[model samples]
Target: MFSGLSAFPLTPMNESGIDEAAFVRLIERLADASVDSIGALGSTGSYAYLSRAERARVVKLAVEHAGNVPVIAGIGALRTSDVQALSDDAQKAGASAVLLAPMSYQQLSADEVFGLYETVTRSLSVPLCVYDNPGTTHFEFSSELYGRIAQLPNVRSIKIPGVPANPAAAKAHIESLRALIPSHVTLGVSGDASAAMGLNSGCEAWYSVIGGLFPKTALAITRAAQAGDMKAATRLSERLQPLWALFDQHGGSLRVVAAAAELQGVVEHPCLPLPLKALDGTGRQQLAVLLDELELA
Candidate 1:
């Protein structure tokens, strides 16, 4: 069903390239924490920057070391053939499922978007998670499109980003998505800041960045929300607000989390791709204080 707390671990790197040793250590930590699943090659993993072979290697590493946790590999690309080939490779590497976003250099039409999934679905035996990340993909899915894609064969889940931070609006949006999609298709939310509210709104899963670094804490909140303890969930969510504010101010979690992971000694270096900078000294100082205050450090 792909429900519960799915951690999106950072792809650690050293001077030569991907730090295989660090990658193994991080995955082992998540497994030790009992995260529901592991998502390798996700946005946090910088799937786009790596070569095809590098991505394949990352998936192989994830499937091997993630310790019985289902690995969801990202197979998104600008072209259909590349996506299909990656999906095939992820399946060969023993990934439980592949995540896809309709990323394009030129804008894609609705039919094009539908065709992309249809093509990939036809080539895969495993299920797919439709990644509706408009912020990065530059392609948005309408409610009708959600219904249409939910009908596609082997489309098991929808990973929607930026579910409103407000609990009321988040609930309404979740309800609308529930009404629009088939019951078989589970709804997963991805924004770390809004995740608690989104889960409270009845999302089946949380594809989380923070969970990668602190799965124990992430699981605590998810378990509380799942157990119908709103008070506990809200309190936990409030604890994360400081970090969430940094994410908001910086425009995303990738850089902020990269810094936090390094500061907490989870990763050796931030090692973000060009043009994307990690938090400065001041930002790290602030993050350190927040992590300590929230007991995340």
Candidate 2:
């Protein structure tokens, strides 16, 4: 469950609330593509915006439709008590593991962050993935913090951010962190654009956003890296440079992927929650052209 491509699908929504049918379609799409795992409610799934009940439903639906593939549910919340409650919900829903990013409104100290993981891990029955997403949470983790949290009972994987672009640097970076955590804890890489480089550099898994919508394409890169065909992995990643550029142009991947999902008719137009708009006409048009050019349409 921890070592391969874990696809994080969008939790499509409508005026009537979650578009259950569409969400199911996305899950089945990932499952049919034989992704190693299904990550429900990561940042891409809009987990933080949804209510606890909504998150529970999303994980339940993911597990139900993911066939034999494991489901890793995101349970990040601002409060430790709430995180504990969310963790309970995920475990009850049959999540194979739970992903957690230390979300906060006020800045948290290193001790506070460690305390959060320590408190939550005690109550957790399923394995936990440390979600070190500094971009969204605005809380960067030090190597020492990672070592502390990873020592907790259920810590099975640490989802670190992107690796350095240079191959040697990327390898050294991963190796430095790898030495800090226990060998039982696998290191998974986020940051979709650098996924190929991270995997080729020795990371064990790719916690991917693009894989959610285009599992086969992402799986190709993962397979290449796993087979030690670094050239093939790099080539595949370079080929998707246009798509990566859209992620940067649009500020982040959530909106661009939402646009792609709409263009593909996999979800309704304007699928994101309020205050977060879909790509504008110009952005959508550019995305549509790229999708066709890249055969992703």
Candidate 3:
């Protein structure tokens, strides 16, 4: 479940709350494309903004529509107790695994972070993926912290933020982390722009954002890397540099992808939750042009 492409789909929403039909369409799209796993309620799914009940519903819907593909539900919350509760909800909803990031309002020490994982892992029946997303969580994990959390009972995968751009440095970075964790715990790479390089550098999986909406395009790069065709993987990823550029220009991928989903009619015009706006008119115009040029429209 941790290997290959784990596609994180947007939790499409409307004024009425979750757009069930649209969300189902997105799940079925990934399933039809044969993605390795479906990541529900991740950052892309707007998990943080949703209530516990909403997150539970999202995971349930994902598992129900994902067919045989495994569902990895994001169970991140600010409090350890809340995270534990969400973990319970994910297990009850039949999630194959749960992704937990150390989400916090105040900064957390390394010991506190380790304690969070240690406490949550104890009651978890399903495997857990260590979500080291420093960008959103605002808490970084050191190599020692990773080693400690990985020693817990359910730790199965560690989702690192991104790899270095240079191939040799990327390989060395992955190798260093590999040595810290148990051999059974797979290393998955996030950051869509560097996914090809990460995979080609020996990471076992790609926890992807773009893979959620355009599974075929993401799969092309994934398959090339898995097949030992490094050049092919790099070529495919480089072809999408324009899209990657949009992610950078717009601050992050959530808004850009939300805009793309709206443009493609996969969801409503403004799919993001309150307090977050969709791309501006100029950004949308630029995205629309690129989407057509890249045949992603």
User: Which residues of candidate 3, in runs, are more than 4 Å off?
Assistant: none
lDDT of 2 by residue, 187-292 (tens): 9999999999999999999999999999999999999999999999999999999989989888889999998999999999879998887787888899999889
By lDDT: ranked, best first: 2, 3, 1
Put down candidate 3 lDDT per residue, 125-207, tens digits, no spaces: 99999999988988888988898899999999999998999999999999999899999999999999999999999999999
Give lDDT per model, in order: 0.86, 0.93, 0.93
Cα misplacement distance, residue 209 of candidate 1 (Å): 0.6
lDDT for 221 (candidate 2): 93
* Candidate 3 weakest lDDT stretch, 10 residues: 12-21
Clashing pairs in 3: none
Candidates 1 and 3 compared by lDDT, better number: 3
Candidate 2 wrongly placed segments (more than 4 Å): none
**Per-prediction TM-score to the true structure, in the order listed:** 0.96, 0.98, 0.98
TM-score of 3: 0.98
Q: Stretches of candidate 1 above 4 Å error?
A: none
For 162-212, candidate 1 gives per-residue lDDT tens digits of 688678898999999899999999999888877788788999899999888
